[model samples]
Target: MKIDVKVPAVGESVTEATIGSWNKKNGEFVKRNEVLLLLETDKASVEVVAENDGVLAIQVEAGQVVKIGATVGILDTEGKASAVSSEAPKTAPVTASQPTQAPVTSSPASAHLSPAVQRIVTENNLNPSQIAGTGKDGRLTKGDVLAASTAAVAPTPAAAPAKTEAKSKAAPAPAIFAASGKLSKQGEKKIVPMTTIRKKIAERLVEAQNTAAILTTFNEIDMTKVNEIRNKYKDKFKEKYGISLGMMGIFTKAAVEALKAFPAVNAYISGAGAGTEIEYHNYYNIGIAVSTEKGLMVPVIKDADQMSLAEIEMAIRDYALKARDGKIGVDDLTGGTFSITNGGVFGSLMSTPILNPPQSAILGMHKVEDRAVVINGKIEVRPMMYVALSYDHRIIDGKESVSFLVKIKEGVEDPERLLFGV
Candidate 1:
């Protein structure tokens, strides 16, 4: 009997999923509960696993869409795993007549490569040894392989100057660049479809813009006191909690206090004028926007208002690790009262963040730099961070928005206020 490998339900909103990539090749023998493929839903990625020990027969290829209960592959229980991996290559006997050379074996670096990346390297007929690895411990990533492939084919387009002369004059150099802003692509462009998660993100962003009365307000935070706190307690905090103190937790706690003072920022308006309701949330579920290889995912920390600074730090840290490993679930991605995104991690000095629909507001954090500012009628250089609050003007008024930000500024600048719940 054969067991069906089906796409498991990830979330209520996720009706269908696209095959992100396959871990096991078609007809390959797999053990029970081994990962077969990664299923990409609109919210998060889920791994489909084999149910029984067997040879796998894949029904769907990568980039294809399938329903929640659809069988992506079939596992044959009778088929046995071969000794292909155990077989060793025969070598000539070493003798004094000829000096022995290192035994021929599989490349150690190849073991670190993912299935998708291995496929790319094989299809391009590229040598992994010649390519420089930028990943951890000099391991080749999918990106490194793509870069190497492009570099190898760099001379191909140049060799055809006569064929490109007509279009070269009319086309600006930037015209050939892809939407990703990659410069000077050497070969023909390949059209790739967006993943399920990317498409969902795009749809929501557009929905937020079209539906909500969006406006962004800016404020600069004096980081002198916050810096002192981090410098003072970061070590002890990490020692006690096993997680370093970070800005997200500080701001999240501060934001919670601010949210309590001005509930309008946390509340969202629903329905049209007459039937519209301003839904106020007593609990704080703060969504921390994480940028992953797939797209932007906001995993919410449920009841953030009740969590301590250290707890907030650990929660966000866990979410970040989960997002990185593609282990984050849809439940983690849903139901956030408010969101906070730090563009500062990518060296962005400032950005106007958009609202995550159903949620009234989002906090944008930016890079901190030392700047000269007046303090008690004296000029001094201090670390400063620019913060932006983007909200729906329909539910939250200008005064409410500005006051909420000021509350956040006060709490972070003076951590004592957060301690006393001021």
Candidate 2:
């Protein structure tokens, strides 16, 4: 019997996905529930597992866009895996005085290599045994092979030093004219097709600009108290929960509290004019905008209001790790009532965040700077952070937006307020 392997429904809005790398090749035997390939959706990359233990028969090639429920591959459940042969190396009988020579045979590691890993190994004429494996059951991943290849090849110092000396001598020149080599590089241009994730991001950004009456409101919060609390409790928190205390947890708590106080900030406009409807959420599902190498992905922390500070930190950490590794799923990307993006990590002082459609507002956290301010008629230096809330003006009134931000500012400046749900 043959089993059909079809593209699963990744998300409610995502109708199609690009077939990413196939871990198993056609005619390769895969175990049931083993990851067979990756499906790259707009938001994240999902792992598609084998339906049964069988010989894989891939129907779609990598990088092809397939609609939901379309067949991607087939599994011949009744077929047996090909057996790999091993033969002893033939050598002349060794005399007692003769030193043993290394075996002139390829590493058996090739037997377990994936298509991507096999390509690299073959290209570089590398012995897979020399490289370390980081994947499951000591299997070599593509990244592991690439890293090993890079480390194995040392730069040619003989040519590099001469080029460096020439560049140093040319540094004194008033103007540097482009040589033929430089001109060649300048003229070099290559067009590459955008990945599915990048295309979807571009579309959504343009859609957000076109559909919403977007407005940004800004405020500054003193971080003196928040900093104190974290500094005081971070060690104990980590020891107790096995996760470090982080800024995202505090921000998530504040955002959830503020959303409760001003529910309008958590609502979105569904239609226009008489058909317009303001859909409000009773529970808080806050998204932490994570930037991965592929693109920006917002994985929601569901029912955030019910989670503790330590749980929020752990969840954020897990989301970031999964997003970085392209393991985040469709369910992780959807149903966000509000979002918080910290540009501070990237050293951004201030910026307006674009809305994630259907979610009316997004809170942007910026770098905290030490500045002098007057307190009780005395000049005091304190760490202050500039926060911005970008809201859909159609649904969230300016007054509501301002109040919502004020609540966030209050909760952050005095985190005890967030704990008490004030």
lDDT of each: 0.83, 0.81
Q: After superposition, how far is residue 257 of candidate 1 from its true place, in Å?
A: 0.8
lDDT winner among the candidates?
1
| lDDT (Cα) of model 2 | 0.81
Model 2 TM: 0.78
* Tens-digit per-residue lDDT, 247-291, candidate 2: 889989999989988888888777675337888889999999998
Model 2's C-alpha root-mean-square deviation from the true structure amounts to 9.1
Cα displacement (angstroms), candidate 2, residue 252, comes to 1.3
Among the numbered candidates, top TM-score falls to 1
Pairs that collide in candidate 2 are none
Residue 172 local lDDT, model 2: 46
lDDT of model 2 at position 163:
64
Kindly report which residue pairs in candidate 1 clash with one another.
none
Clashes of each: 0, 0
